[model samples]
Target: MALLPTTAQAAQTHPDPRPLTGQEIIHDPTVARLKSGGYVAYSTGGIIGARLSADGRHWDDAGNAFAEPPAWWYEYNDKADPWAPDLSYRDGRYWLYYAVSSWGSNHSAIGVATSPSGRPGTWTDHGKVFSSERTDSWNAIDPAIVRADGRLWMSFGSYWTGIRMVELDPVTGKTVPGAAVHHLATRPDAPYAVEGPYIVKHGRHYYLFASYDACCSGVNSTYKIKVGRSASATGPYVDSAGTPMLNGGGDLVLEGHGRFIGTGGQSVFRDKGKDWLAYHYYDAEDDGTPKLGLNRLSWTKDGWPKVS
Candidate 1:
């Protein structure tokens, strides 16, 4: 286990993202430290846009993950573009899961793909793993995968009733047929606005991180990231004050600050034995352009995560 940062070090740390250069523009990025060395970031644009970095600080645009969208994607949107991809490595291969949908519509699906290397243009599409329709209370987008107690689970949702989870087949990496949908987090008020769920385990508890409020409105975007923790993977998660996330409980993680406006849509990964938070923010200094945000994630002495 990594040593916990002292309170003095935590106080001196900035909540803003670390300085980055070279092709930093991206949205809803999921970054993975490559087994082959360096890193790759996949995001919600251009048939699943990709960026590569030899060193963690500088990046270069690589290209799209797929040359063309699958035929089924057109059923959700005319352009067939995918969004909010989540990438993970397991079972000796890389698994890429992404969502397809039209804005403001609940007709959506999450699809899976595999690659020997977690690089752009190398993935093989594996069709839909889960989906939702207008009649359903939960929208099937923004997936985050987590493994716990020897079982695989996927947490997803946006806008409708809030965050949800379903078990996945370990062998196929798809939703287990007849698996029950488990509610995770949401606002107590209607039109729940919360989205982009990412869960990470720390010590004895599972922490759920998610974005709350409006996103994608440039400088006006109100996006912010918050978190809660539960003893089990699927939970009745609560904030520091003991308020249930189901009742709008989440400890603030990151919010808009100065040049970094509307920071949210986050994912966490481990690199060189240290955990890092990866997300995007609308840049006020750059006319609200979406740009990558990276920050080292440290644990408090009490075990809660703190982004440095």
Candidate 2:
């Protein structure tokens, strides 16, 4: 869903995302801090791009999330760049949610896989969890999952109708029966662009973060990260100004400034008592290549989030 930039966030100075020697060419990435005191990342690729980080700063290539992608993936993307994977561990296995679809096409599917340890080559593909087609108004991509109160929920969508959420079953790794798909956030205007939904429960509220505008155009990209929070897991979420997310409301969390372009497609992770925001951004100086971004996330006294 690439579009023109709204303002000049083009990097005129230093490139953000510093530069990892081994891990480059990132696209919509998700990470899991390994039990061995390192980090593993999964992102858009044939199967999934796997990278390893012992100290979170330096990184190295591990492998693909699956040794061979399930055959069904070819039905979605002919080129097969599997986009936006979400990773989490549960029930003695690592649960991975990944998307398969072509750009600007609604013929999309979200699939799940499990691994004993969250290493590459070890995942067992369980097949499609959810999908959407040409007839549907919403595109099923960029999936993110969160646990709230006591239930598992997944949020995903892009371009068409903004973001959508459905409750998930922990055991089956699918949607819970009788659960409804809730419309979470949307831009609702002419371009009507918003996507990349992530949910994090901080303090007494549930916060939803998403990307706005065009993504994927290198340094020319215009993506930015925004957030809204709700009292309940399923909401009527509102921004700092009390504007509802359903009504196109979001509070800006990060945007391109300096050399970072399109600062979005992010995930919130907690490590060692601190929360970290992980995402990818196009480099203006480096021909707009998408690269990994890591920032420390802190909460304000009044309950909003700020990423440093």
Candidate 3:
């Protein structure tokens, strides 16, 4: 016989154990699945190589992806900031959009490169996709692309204002001129910022997920992830609680302290009949250095999603 049915034992338990901390440095994680059934993550810290994992945990670094900086990188001398990178598969090619710029400002541009295979040593720079003008009001960075309803869309920006989206030609991987780019979301009232736009589709709606608050500067950072949804690809998205994301309507999706902190710059992927959220977060115990974090996402009956 066993003693059971105590009040504490019968109560609802939080799914997460205490927050995880003390991880090695890993930032700006980009996830891709190989044909060989393994996963690859390309991250920051001069780490241009792939991290191979058969089960998405326990990884081995495959060395730097690029042996030398391509001639086109203007600030290649200062190689610290690799920033946000978006990876996609199109026309038997693997396309990567990466940013090299000063953090949190528009003194930057997004560059495009492609590879015949998803492996390293095969990338060819396609040139800059978009850059910021000194006179412009918004910061141009963090390029995320997706195909919806037979159209290609790229969403990008930082705390300077909010996230914006523009139409793209699926064939050329370039912006479609005269395309109506519009604001998708922002947070003027929040403490500091809204940035890192990662968009995806679910059911009849398109969802835009972004990180908020200060991302750098260690334990003082207030970084977290929030989300908004809309019925159209170019959105006036709303949060789960029915607030307008365009009007700063967003609901908290994930935050940090115990296992993760400053968790944002996310990408969503579907694998093995399940959805996974891949993002970077600062390790709590390692003096707030950023690292890769993976979580499983599930949908509610009402169509909203949560990480489990």
Candidate 4:
């Protein structure tokens, strides 16, 4: 997953998300490049609201991943609502992983589903993969998967003890039996606000990208994207100056500036040999509407990621 460095991006000015049209409102979005030549995006809402794009620029609503939540979802949230889905293609099928929980409660779970066609209504639910109880220090709300060393790993957590990881059975896409939970990133300060972790391997390192501070507060949201890198999938990740992530160490990647506010909840994907970053940001002009944000990701000469 090595990306060659392109021309250095401008340091002073940052690029805005590419303009989008039709069914633009979404939150905590995850996108998968479909085998059918278009793209489908799933996000937090009614059974996971969906959006589609033919060219990755213009988007349209495509309904949801499920008509109704699975019966088990009620144990966590009475509404049976889901959030922060992660979608990807593997083994000639589409695998979707998502989070289910109510706000401010550590009682949460991550669920999985599969689809022959990565369409909105075609998925088969696989139920809960991993979860956390109120007594657990880590909350299981945001799930992101990465395969390394012929092993499948899922990184997830929020608010309660930041980010954590556990190994998953590739065939089942569920946490391995009796697998030890590994802590990935967290703020040293109490009530750690870091969360929404997405990991990607580029070159020889695995980079952990996460959202920092408060989100879901509309224009007042302070969410921004940050990054730290490690040589191992389960890591003691560190920033450029060698500060460990457990101590609130991270290098700023993207943040709110001007009209685009609260830029976080990010995932990275490869398309046509180039990498792109997908996330959500509050639009200051449109009454703080949460909308999809995309940026072309480039590598710096030093092998770090730079989004333009």
Candidate number of the best lDDT: 1
Clash pairs detected, candidate 1: none
| Each prediction's TM-score versus the true structure | 0.95, 0.92, 0.88, 0.95
Better of 1 and 3 by TM-score: 1
Candidate 4: clashing pairs of residues: none
Put down candidate 1 lDDT per residue, 1-308, tens digits, no spaces: 99988765453324778899899999999999999999999999999999999998999999999998988999888999899999999999999999999999989999999999999999999899999999999999999999999999999999998999999998999999999999999998888989999999999899999999999999999999999999999998999999999999999888888888888899999999999999999999889999999999999998888989
**Pairs with steric clashes in candidate 3:** 19-258, 19-259, 20-258, 20-259, 22-285
TM-score head-to-head 3 vs 4, winner: 4
Models ranked on lDDT: 1, 4, 2, 3
lDDT of 4 by residue, 19-112 (tens): 8888889999898777788888899987899999999988999889998789999999999989899998777888999998999999999999
RMSD of each: 5.9, 6.1, 5.8, 6.1
Predicted structure 4: lDDT: 0.91
What is residue 94's positional error in candidate 3, in angstroms? 1.2
The CA lDDT of each predicted structure is 0.94, 0.85, 0.74, 0.91
* TM-score, predicted candidate 4 vs. hidden true structure: 0.95
lDDT of 3 by residue, 196-299 (tens): 88888999988888888878756666777888888997888999878888677787778775656677778887778788888877767878877778788778
Model 1 residue runs over 4 Å out of place are 1-14
Lowest summed lDDT across 10 adjacent residues in model 2 is found at 10-19
